[model samples]
Target chain A: AQSVTQPDIHITVSEGASLELRCNYSYGATPYLFWYVQSPGQGLQLLLKYFSGDTLVQGIKGFEAEFKRSQSSFNLRKPSVHWSDAAEYFCAVRFSGTYKYIFGTGTRLKVLA
Target chain B: SQTIHQWPATLVQPVGSPLSLECTVEGTSNPNLYWYRQAAGRGLQLLFYSVGIGQISSEVPQNLSASRPQDRQFILSSKKLLLSDSGFYLCAWSPTSGHQETQYFGPGTRLLVL
Candidate 1:
């Protein structure tokens, strides 16, 4: 079964500092990956997605993720953090042509001002 | 652009009460619809998905059920609510056949079971 794992349960970063959130997937073949962010009491917003080509994918709000197949990881990164960036992040994986997506447990990001 | 909408931004219901959550998609047709639950501080748990009318696929067996009576409307219902059902319920739609396509999410409905 395809599944996703986010190692970090929570992370705290200072404003303007760089940020990185880790995500790992267990799948036999290449998988479609996505990153979503959710603010308090709000629905998830898609940050970015990786379907094919370009190991390094850019997303909204200055976020980017690199898909490292060998490592089974797609880690999200941002050059600088903002207070509004404090939210929950989720990593999702879906097999090609499949109808289902498996999501990680999520990582809570806290940005300090 | 396609947009998804879910109603009753927040709902409070007692255990054993019935539930009815509505989801609709606009500016799109023959889209795949999905219902997901997010526990506090946790990942999303896909509850059900529909590819077309009368075609419901359940990802997780729970106290909830879903139906697509119209091409653009999807509904999630439950005969009896449970405390475990309290969470953030999200409605999503995708242009392609299924999860292989990038999904667009609704604002979501927050349900609290007392």
Candidate 2:
């Protein structure tokens, strides 16, 4: 079974500071990884995805993630944080031939002004 | 461009009451539809998915059921609602063919079962 784990439950960062959210997955093979963000009372928006090719994938809103196969980790990073960037982040994993995606518990990001 | 829509934006229902939630997709055909629930402070739990009309696949055995009568429409229903069912219900769609594996989400429907 493919499962994703987000170690941080909540993270607080000051405006203009860098941010990193950790995500680890347990899968038999290299799975399709994705990062999504959800605002309060809103649906999730895709931030980035990694299917193949480069380990580092850039996404919307200046977000980027690096897939590390050896460590089974796909961590999201942003060079600078803004107050509007506060939201819940989730990591999802899907197998090559499957449609079902397994999501992590999520990490709540709080950006301070 | 594909878009997914779920309604009503918010719902309040009593326990033991019947439930119905609708989801529809536009600008796409033969897409895969999915129903997911997010409990308070929890991640998404996929309830059901469909690759085509009348082909519903359940990911979890629960009090809810899903049906796809049309290629673009999906519905979630329950004979009797439970308190545990009170959560944010989301609808998503993805291309069954092609190289697009990303699922686009709807605005979602928030259900509160009293």
DockQ of predictions, in order shown? 0.74, 0.81
lDDT of each: 0.92, 0.94
As a whole number from 0 to 100, the lDDT of residue B108 in candidate 1 is 95
Question: What is candidate 2's fraction of native contacts?
Answer: 0.74
In model 1, chain B matches the true chain B with a TM-score of 0.95
Highest-lDDT candidate:
2
lDDT of 2: 0.94
DockQ, candidate 2, vs. native dimer: 0.81
Q: What is the number of backbone collisions in each predicted candidate, taken in the order shown?
A: 0, 0
Tens-digit lDDT track of model 1 for B72-92? 999999999999999999999
Docking class of 1: medium
Model 2's TM-score against the true structure: 0.98
Tens-digit lDDT track of model 2 for B59-87: 99999999999999999999999999999
